[model samples]
Each structure stands twice: as C-alpha cells, then as structure tokens.
Target chain A: MSARNHEQWTSPPKLAEGEWVDSRIYSDQTIFEEENEKIFKHAWIPVCHESELKDAYDFRTMTIANEPVIVVRGKDMQVRAFLNVCPHRGNMIERRPSGSFKEGTPSGTPKRMTCMFHAWQFDMKGKCVYISRQEEGYQDRLCTADVGLRELKCEVYFGGFVWVCLDDDIGMTVEDWAAGALDCLAPSLNEEPLEVFHYHKAIIPCNFKLWHDTNCEFYHDFLHYHNRITGFNDAYFARKNSGFKNGHINVGSFEVQYDNYEGFHSREELSFPHLPPNHWYMIDMFPGVNFNLRGSALRCDLMTPLGPDKVMIEFRGLGLASDTPAERQTRIDHHNSIWGPFGRNLHEDLLAVTAQGSCMHPSAEKRNILQGRHENETIHDENGMRHYYHEWGRWLNRSPSNPDEEFDEALIAAASAKPAEVQANA
Target chain B: MAEKHASTIEQIKDVIYKSCLYQDDLEWNSWLDMCSDDYHYAIRAFSPEIRADMEYMGGGLEYMKSLTQMLPKHNTDNSPLKRHCTVYKVEVADDGKSASATSSFVVYQTMLDGINSHVDAGESRLFLVGRYNDKFEISNEGVKFSDREVRLDTRRLDKGSHWPI
Candidate 1:
C-alpha cells in the first residue's frame, strides 16, 4: 500500500519464478545480441505477403536479424528469398525497398538482379547468370557457377504470407512453428486471396519484445478508451487466453458492440469469409509477430529488432482481393478506427512501451516486472507473457527471473508445458 | 479587379493561418467553428513499401467532433504542438463564393510532461511535415473550410499522436 525503500524495491516479488522476469532481459546489450543469434535467426518470420509480389520479377527487400534479405517472384511463378549481398565484394545487391527487375537497368540487363558495383547478375532462382569479364578477371579460379547468391529457406503459407528462415537447417515448417496459434484465423484468411490496402511503419524506441508483450495480453485495454466503450462486456471478459507450444498465444473470439461508441457503426456487413459478424480474434506468434482480425479487416504487425532499445514495426491492413471499391473503403475505415497511427488506440500502446523502454535503460536500476495475475487464463490474465518469457529464457539459456543465473529447466516447467487443448490440436 | 482579387486572397490566407492556430492551441471548438457543417477532413500519405497511397484518418464534421470529445478519456501525450504554415497559392472563384488554396505546413512538438520528458524535456522536435490541400466556401459572414486533405511526407512518427496533424 506504500512505496518501498531501495532494498525492498530492488528485491524480487513474492511470486512464482515463472510469474516474473528481470528487467535486464529488456535492456542489456549482450542479451539483445544473443537473441538475434539464438531466437530470431532460426524462427520463421513472415517478411511480406505474397500479394505484394504478384507480377513476375517483382521483389521486396528487408532485413532479418540485421542481415539484408530479398524476396522475389520468378518467371516460373515461384517466390524465393536470398541474401541481398553480392559474392564479389559483399556489397548490397539491391538498395531499393521494393521494385521489379523486369526491365533493363542502366548497369544490367532485364529480368535480373544486377549488383551495380561489379554488374554481377543473379537470375530469378538466385543463380549467377552473368559475371562481368569473368575469364579476364580470375581466369579459371572463379566461374559464374561458383558465385550464386546464398538462398534462404522460404515458404508461402498461412494466408499467402512469405515466411523466411535464416537457418537453412531449421527442421520446422511455418505450420509446425505456428503450433495451432494461427488456427483461429486459418479458415477466414485462407478462404480467399487477401490484398494489403494500407501500409505504414514506425521506429519505436523500445525493445521488440516489449511490443510483443503488449500484443500478447489484453490487460492494458484499460489504457484504450475506445475499447472500453465498445468492448467491455461479459463476452470480452470471458474470452480465453490460450497458450500454445513455442510461446504462441491466441485470444478467443468475442463479438464487439461497435454501436456503443458514438459515430461508429457495426461492421457486420463486411466480415471476413466464414467469420461471424463483429467477432474479434488475435494470434501472437513466437518472438514478435501479431495478427489481429476484427471482422472486416485484418491487421498484421511485423517487428524487426533494431537495437537493445529500438524496434521497427511494420503495420499492414488487408482485405479480400475481390472486394469492391466501396467494400474496400469500409474495411479501411474499420481498420483505421482503432489500429492506425491516429487511431483511437494504437498511439496509446506506443506511448506505454516507449515509457517502459525509458525506465528499463541498461544504466537504470534493475527491478522485477511481475506477470502474476491469474484468472483461469481469461482475457485479463498475464499467462501469455509468462509463457513467452519462459520460452525466451530457454532459447538464451538464461533465467528470466534472474538473468545472471543459468536457466534451470525445472523452474518453469509449468509454463513451458503445452496446454491440453493445444496438445490435442497438435 | 486586381485589387479586389488581392483582398480575397488575403482573406483566404487569414482563414488558413487561423485554422492552424486553433488546432495547435487545442482549441477544438474554435477550429470547428471555422469549418462548414459538411466539412470533410483527411490525413493521407504515400508508402513506397506498398506502392500505394494510404489514408490514415478521415471523417466528417460530426465524426471529428465525437473523436475530440473522447480525447480527454484517452491516454495521450501532453506535449504542446506549434504549427508553421505558408499559404502558397489561392484561387478565388468568379462568383467569389468558393476558393481553393495550397499551403505547406510543419508541426513541431515541444515536450511538456509526456513519457520521454525525463530526457527530452523542453526540447522541440519536428513532429510532421506536410502540404495541406484546402477548399473553402466564402460568404458575407466569413470564410469556412469545406474540405482539407493533409498529405504528409514524413511517414515514421516516432511516438505517434492521437491528434491529427
């Protein structure tokens, strides 16, 4: 009921080990580097949607764990990913965020990703098609066959998203890694081809995991006035928060009463295929990705960690590719009312996580972040974050409650174990 | 004829400046008063990543007023905003009943007591830079905004604002 002194404030709370985590996991530089190596490199990340590269030779470039990556659509209608670095001098092959190699550039021929540095050209399959003056430069030492781009493991799944993994040896497919977390939206998203109607990104000054934590739990709905007005009902409070294997979580569906908010109307007319009117569902994947479906529109948040205290979040709003112009406009309105930059709720989330980042700076005093609320694993419970940090600890082999200590397998057995429902689905 | 046209342009400029001032001061009532009952407002930007134009916010007058009324109940940054605008072109109708203007604007946010104020207090950061495409209805009473579209150039809003820019 009162403020504590320094000693009392710094000590761990009187809670179970898995119910709390050390703040250093969010602020330490070493832990951030280890996360890139241990967690992100092996995880299947949905870099972009397939609809983005509908035309032949169209491509998109992004970074995964600070390594430049390019995803392209070939003439054979296959999508492939490769390291955007050239084999000659390690220069970045493509500088633009997105474009098509279908036309001839000033330095290279058509239908090829040409490195402006040495004009080394790579074909749609990432095969080295041409090396400028190859015989004159290296004689027999090097040939075009020896200098192909390093291709990454790529797949198109879960509603036509282009998923990529940095580790070629990673044994899990995107569906296996999902572990039933995305099953809730599978029917709706897979029912038809979806096209992204809106796109924007923000570079927030916060750890990437912090943003994921906000998405994993609904306890912070109190911070969103719009949600309070439209969604504080019995169904909302009773929505189950289910944790799946590999740190994934899903919040069960509940119909939103959009009419409760002034100047807002029900979105029943444009609900996704096979979805009930005004129903809301969410999927938080392992590491940092979120998919939120609010009846009419789908919002996907893809996070790329930039530093210990910075992360870049790309937000996209999608609707059916067959939507009429009027239908698409309605879906965009539904999406922007709550998820857009000037939406009623999104900026509030950014405000809170950035504040957490400010307090948890590496130089600041260390403390415990409690995730101990237990409500039969319902909407307001904190089990989602607990499950996430448990998996995070296992990956880095460091204790969540005490990062200086080595992780003990027995400490978080309860949180790490898959729920019976998840096991049954698996 | 030239003198009368110059006077009409000056009136249009005054309306644009006053609108910015009212919004920057958070005087929602005054800002709304300068808008017609059918006022349409929107904020838009083009994203190269998606290769499309995006409308971040849009509403009619009633919708905007309702959002403003809910602002106090929401969690928002308290940083004060100051807008600098330059009216570049104003074209008046032959009947003097309507006009259109194009103006460039830059909004700066001064830290007061928001989350990052501990380290960024008293500092002014460039919040957003955009061009405003505006339409007005001129009358004997005064000039009022009929439509305004804010086309922004800066896409990355570090800590985004609840208020429209």
Candidate 2:
C-alpha cells in the first residue's frame, strides 16, 4: 500500500506471467536491432498507398529497417518495389523522397531510375538498361543484362495499399499475414478506390511497439477528453478487442455520438460505403502499423523504427477517390478534427508515449509494465497487449516478463487461461 | 491622405502584434475578440513527400472558439508558446474598408513542467516557423481579422500541440 524500497520496487508484480512486460524490452539496443532482423525485415509492410503513385514512372522512396526501398509504377502499369541502391557501386539511385521519372535528368535518360554517381540507368521494372561505356571498360566481362536492381516481393492489396517484404521467400501474402484482422473494414475500404488527402509524420522518442500497444488497447481513452466526451456510452464500454494470428488485433465498431461534443456533428452522411452511421473501427498489425476508419475518413499510421528510443510514424488520411470536391472537403474536416497534427486527441497520445519513453531509457531502473486488467475482453481490458507480447516473445525467442530468460509457453498459457483454470492451477 | 494611410498601417501592425501576444498568454477569449464574426482560420503546409498542399486544421470563428475553450480539459503540453512575428508587407484597399498583409513568424516553446521537466526545464526549442497571410476588415469598430492562413514550412512537429500555433 505504501512506497516500497529498492528491492521491492525492482521485483515483478503479483500478476501471473505474460500479464506484464519488462521495461528492458523497450529500452535495450540489442533487442531493437534483433527486432529489425526477426520481425520487421520479414513482415509484409504497407509502404505507401497506390494512389500516391497513380501514374506510370511515378515513384516513392522510403526505408524499412534502415534499408532504403523505392516503389515505382512501370510503363506496363505494374507497381514494383526494389532496393534503391545501384548495382554498379551500391550508391543510392533515387535521392528524392518522391517524384516522376517521366523526364530525364542531366545525368540520366528519360523514364529511367538513374544513378547520378556513375550514370547507370535502370528501367521502371528494375532492369539495367544502360551502363556507362560497358564495351570499353570490361568488354565481355560485364553486361547490362547481368546487373539489375534487387526486386522485392510486393503486392497491392487490402484497399490499394502497396505492401512489400524484404525477404523474398517469406511464404505468406499480405492477405495471409492479415489473417482476417482487416475484415471489419474490408468492405468499406474496397467498396471504392481511395485516395490520400492528408499526410504528415512525427518522429516520437519511443519504441515502435509502444505506439502499436496504444492502438491495441483502449484503456488510455481516459487521456483523450474528446473521446471521453463523444464516446462514453454503454455500447462504447461493451466494444470487444479481438486478437488474430501473427500478433494482429482488431477493436470492434461502435456508433460514436459526435453530437455530445459542442460544435461537432454526426458523420452519417459522409461515412464510407456499407458502414453504419457514425461508426469507428481500428486494426493494429504486428510490428507497428495501424488502420483506423472513423465513419467519414480513414487514417493509417505506418511506423518506421529509427532506434531504440526513436520511431518515425507516418500518418495518412484517405477518402474515396470518386468523392466530389465538397465531399472530400467534408471528409478532410472530419479527419482533422480528431486525428490531425493539431487535433484534440493525437497530441495527447503522443504526449503519453513520450512521457513513457523518457522514463524507460536504457539507464532507467527496470520496472513491470502491467497488462493485467481483465474485463472479459472488453474495450478497457489489457488482454490485447498480453496477446501481443506473447507473439513478440515467440518471434524474438525471449520472455516478455523476463527478457534475460528464454520464452516459456507454459507461463503465457497459464496467464491467459480461463479464470476457473487459473484458480485451479493456483 | 498619405498620413491617413500611414496611421492605418500602424493600427494594422498593432492588431497583428496583439494577436500573437494574446495567444502566447493563453488568453483565448481575448484572441477571439480580435477576430471578426465571420473570421476564418487555417493552418496549412506543403508536403514535398506527397507533392501536395495539405490543410492541417481550419475552422470558423465559432468552431475556433469552441476548440480553444475545450483546450484546458484536454491533456496538452504545459510549456508556454512565445511567438515572434515581423510584419513584412501591408496593402490597404482603395476604399479603405479592408487590407491584406503578410508576416513572418517563429514560435519558440520553453519546457516548463512535464514528465522530464526535471531535466528539460528552462530548455527552449523552436516549435514552428511559418508565414501568416492575413486579411483584415477596417470597420468603424476597429481592425479585426477576417482571414488568417498560417502557411508552415516545418512539417514535423514532435509531440505536436493541441493549441494552434
């Protein structure tokens, strides 16, 4: 009941295993690097929406686990992803974040990804089309056909999101990876083509998983005054948190009473196709990706882990591509009111995670992060995080509650067992 | 006529300065008083990454007032914002009923108290840098802002603010 000494403070909580996680998992540099190798490098990450690269030869450049990747649309109208490095000298081919290769640069040809370093030209399909003086330099030893940009496994799925995996033989498509986690909003997202209307990114000082954890659980809704005012009814409290395979989690939908807040109105008219009026759904994919659909607008958060203590989160807001100008404006208005950089809710989430980051630094004392709340898997329950860390442990081959030890299946099994079974075991 | 224009410009400059002062002081009601009944406010930025112009936030006078009034209830950064503005150009309407002006502004935030206040207290960081494209109505009452567009050059706001910049 009172403040404890150092020995008691450092000990684990009274909850069963897998009901809590060690702070070191968020602050350790070695574990951060290991995550890049075991989880992110192989995961099918949604790099960019297809609408961003609408035309042939238009490309977007981004990074996954520090590896620069370029996604471009070829003349054949196929979206492809490749390593941004040039084959000749490994120099990064595209320096710009995004642009069209329809026009030729000073050192390159038209419709080609040109490496300014050595004038090596690559076609939209990643074929090495031109090499600088190939015949004179090495004669038959080297040819354009032998060296090409490394292509990655890419697919446009789940409502035109361009998903790419660094590992070519990962043996699972993006749909398989999702494992029905996105079924809640699949109809609405796929009902019509969507185009991004707003985009912004923030580099928060926190582990990438911490951001994903926030999305998986609604216990932190108390921190958001806007949500509390608009969504504190019985239905909101009864919303379920469902976990899927591969660490994905889905929060069921509920009709948000937007009229509860002053100057706010219902989003029924502008809601996405097939969606009920004023409803909201959220899906949190493993290793940090979030798809949130709030009736009128769709907001996706894509995380790129920069370091143990830093994560760059890209936020995209999308609406139907067939929307009229007025409709699009209304969607943008609804999106910005709660989820924008200057919105009523997002800043509070960022503040909460940043505060956690500051205290869980590498030198900070170790502590237990409790995920023990059990409210029959309702919105406020912590079962989502408990399920997530179970997958995290399996992938990293380490324990979530005690990282120094190997992962133990019995510990997690006992922790998440039924109340009667847990009591019997005790 | 030249003297009248000069005095009008001075008054316009005073209105611009007072707007920033009131916002920095968190005097939301006073800041709203400086705006006309039909005032429009927007914060915008050009994203090179997406190759588009994005409106991050926009609202009318009533909406702005409501949001600002609800700010204290939300969890927000307690650090105070200090806006430094320099009015660059102003043009008075031929009828002398309205005017348009552009000013450069840089906002700095001093960390006062938060989770890491023990270590970050007294530290100041550049929060945002932008230009204000403002339109004012020169009515019988006084100079009131008719429209204000904050075109920001900085896009990445780490732990962004709930309050307008």
Highest-DockQ candidate: 2
Kindly list the per-residue Cα lDDT of model 1 for residues A1-426, writing each as its tens digit.
Answer: 499999999887887678888988889999999999999999999999998898999999999999999999999999999999999999999998888999888889999999999899999999999999988998999998999999999999988999999999889899999999999999999999999988888998788999999998899999888888889889999999999999899999999999998888999999999999999999999899999999999999999999998999999999999999999988988898899888888989999998999888878778899888776788998889988887888899999989899888786885545456645654
Ten contiguous residues with the weakest lDDT in model 2 chain A: A417-426
- How many residue pairs clash (N, CA or C atoms closer than 3 angstroms) in each of the candidate models, in the order given? 0, 0
Native-referenced DockQ of model 1 = 0.76
Off by over 4 Å in 1: A414-426, B1-4
C-alpha local distance difference test of each model: 0.90, 0.91
Error of 2 at A273 (Å): 0.8
Error of 1 at A176 (Å): 0.9
TM-score for the second chain in candidate 1?
Answer: 0.95
Lowest lDDT 10-mer window, candidate 1 chain A?
A417-426
Best by lDDT: 2
Candidate 1 lDDT over residue span B1-165, tens digit each: 436678989989998999888999899988988999999999999888878788899898998899888788888889999999999999898888998999999999898756668678899988899999999998999899999999999889766788866
User: After aligning candidate 2 to the native by TM-score, how far in Å is the CA of A172 from where it should be?
Assistant: 1.0
